[model samples]
Target: MSDDLLNAQNDLARALVEARLLLPSGVPGLFGRGTVLEDVIERIDALVVRTAEGDGARAERWRFPPILPRALLEKSEYLSAMPQLAGSVHAFDGTVQDHQKLLARVHGGEDYGDLQKQTDVALVPAACYPVYPIVASDGPLREGGRLVDVFSYCFRHEPSPDPARLQSFRMHEYVRIAPDADDARAFRDGWIDRGLLLLRGLGLAAERAPANDPFFGRAGKLLAVNQRDQELKFELVCPITSAEKPTALASANYHQDHFGSLFGIKNADGTTAHTACVGFGVERVAIALFKTHGIDVAAWPVDVRARLWAP
Candidate 1:
């Protein structure tokens, strides 16, 4: 990471802001999308839906809200590993005097943001977290498996200047649950191939590589090493802001029986269900497309346009 390379990345970030492709909201890692970027994101999502349909997987589709029950997240114990990135919703529940003081602080240009109290819900950390509990509550699977497609706006507190790393973003996920471990593993492997091909169709040269979550703190380094050693996470990365270091626009993860054991999801024969998921960072892929093919949508390659906007 040379200083010159860092400067170049910052220049691109400024260019995007000037071009109205990105609108900074005075908050780092959070930006308002202009029409052009929003259109690109929508088209990318449509392409994902089309590709998922063509994969011949009969998956139940679901759309989840940006926030989920805090208790549900607590049960998953995600905070134990990644509390640094979690976003909890807060609100002002106060009397008139309290409101007056808060209003005065804001009018006087003070740091009044902390006046809000924590709510019962937390912004969802990942699109797939809300799905496991839903599936588990249904008891054992009669057919030995289940396939589902879920999409949601995920929130993390990470603040960075990189355009691809937003505090709030949408994730499109396809998840599989099965009694046999091999069934889930094979499903994940198949999606890795399909996801790479989908990126190629968009004129993005992506490669599948081993990856790990940004686990928090000292104990997390060991967790990350173990995860990579187990080969549990794979990412489809293409260079967006940097040529040498590519960005991960999508990932395929094998959860094994981790969620199943916690949720009590089981097979009819009484075996814990194995789980796997493939997730696409919708905005990140759109950013890569703009970086690779230029920001002008109409001038993009005809094949790329066709694949994204095809009927």
Candidate 2:
């Protein structure tokens, strides 16, 4: 990392600490958010709700747990794409003797975590992931297709000092299961515009840019490139901490029947449903708001406050 980049990280850390928006928990990439920060996040969440519920579109609201079935995750091919980021749940399943040995190892400051065994559950990486299988299992979709609003606490095992890049966070997604690729693409495009408008309404200047997922391995590089080249992923970004490299507060993605094929989701015509989703990183948006408009919520501009709080 460049010296300037390091200094920027340090500066942001100091700002977060001084404002008491976050408390360091002796762990990198994991911090306890203060009430003020929570309030900001709640405001952002209200914005998400407005977007999801607006336009007279009926949406099925869903809230998923943090952990999902490991088998489902594997079927989704998430492990192959970004194994480094995935977090698997592990638990102790040994006898009492094993527990005694584990305690002794802990007391001696040895490697005691090996006593745990991998469980069937893995931490959910995205809010929309768990919804695919459930929707698929219900048989073919109705003639016009389905729209879902899903939210979940997601986890990734990436450890970093930057508060914006968290290991555990919440994601709110508006997903569309369409009849064909054209419908999916149209839904994604519409949301990209609306997402930008949503941010602009909050007084955040955001721009749309083609983006790619952080795929793993050599083969995964090709996949990432193809995804970007095909314009499957786009992000609404603004300068939160770094002016040169903006942070993505929202993302719009068209999966092109990938999830539908894997989970056997079919359309009314017996064809695979095309999938698309618009995701908002709730905490990340709050960080952007704090950085752009300052941490004092009461001092924020009247328009932004009214847009978030007013009925």
Candidate 3:
């Protein structure tokens, strides 16, 4: 790693320590402070498992696999969508203190003995960040395109210490890649409705609203605004957290021809694929549900309970 990069990581490590993040004793049951988040995850996991039966190996049901390289991040234009949120991953092999060890060591200014080498690569900011390259390297698909159930345990460096805003969470995605624009748009729309159905089933008040990623710089700012106005990106937000503020639980992103063009992902005849993804922040939804339905999972409405537990 470059000296500059190493310094940046060390600085970030220090900051995380200051923030009471970088939990080494293992993240508490805190993110799931109430049992409702865990229960919601149970529902989300069941849904993911059902979705994954057809996803081949990339499915979260099988196993959480090694995330693809950072190079793919460039292809998917994720840097433009969420540059500030992306996690930069690297390893520590040198004799000096590494970022992995830093997580545990910073607590008392003392190192954990027998610290193991961190072979695991970058921190994941979002679950969808891993899927594009895997599809790219798996060779070209048939003209019809492919759909996959991609999900993961993701992490983010929060700008603030809001319990509602966690530093780590589970993310779920129903991603579609099709040879034509219409199919991708259709898939994006399909998930939007499904998300609303889930919300309604839970008796939570949520609506689809235009949203943009936290992109960096002037061009990114304009791009976000344009995207929002055009309704290129939309969020499923619940107005339960506060009377004036709604919590966003899911997102539908229409990537027009972005990923296909960047990664040369095309059909058998070499037509570029149009890509779209539906993203669900599992914990966020659970939090929203908790606030909406109260902390007692057992007391949740019979209809919502059935939907959550339904096959």
Alpha-carbon local distance difference test for all models:
0.87, 0.88, 0.66
- TM-scores of all predicted structures: 0.93, 0.96, 0.75
Error of 3 at 291 (Å): 0.3
The digit string of per-residue lDDT tens for model 2 on 203-244 reads 898999887578999989998998988899899998876777
Cα-based lDDT at residue 129, candidate 1 = 92
Q: In what order do the candidates fall by TM-score, top score first?
A: 2, 1, 3
Compare the candidates by TM-score and give the number of the best one. Answer: 2
Off by over 4 Å in 2: none
Clashing pairs in 1: none
- The candidate, 1 or 2, that scores higher on TM-score is 2
Q: Which residue segments of model 1 deviate by more than 4 Å?
A: 108-115
- lDDT (10s digit) by residue, model 1, range 45-115: 88788778865558899888999999888888788778899988888988898899899998999987677
**How many steric clashes between backbone atoms does each model show?**
0, 0, 1
Maximum-lDDT candidate = 2
Candidate 1 local lDDT, residue 239: 86
Q: What is the lDDT of residue 162 in candidate 2?
A: 71
What is the full ranking by lDDT, best candidate first?
2, 1, 3
- Which stretch of 10 consecutive residues in model 2 shows the poorest summed lDDT? 48-57
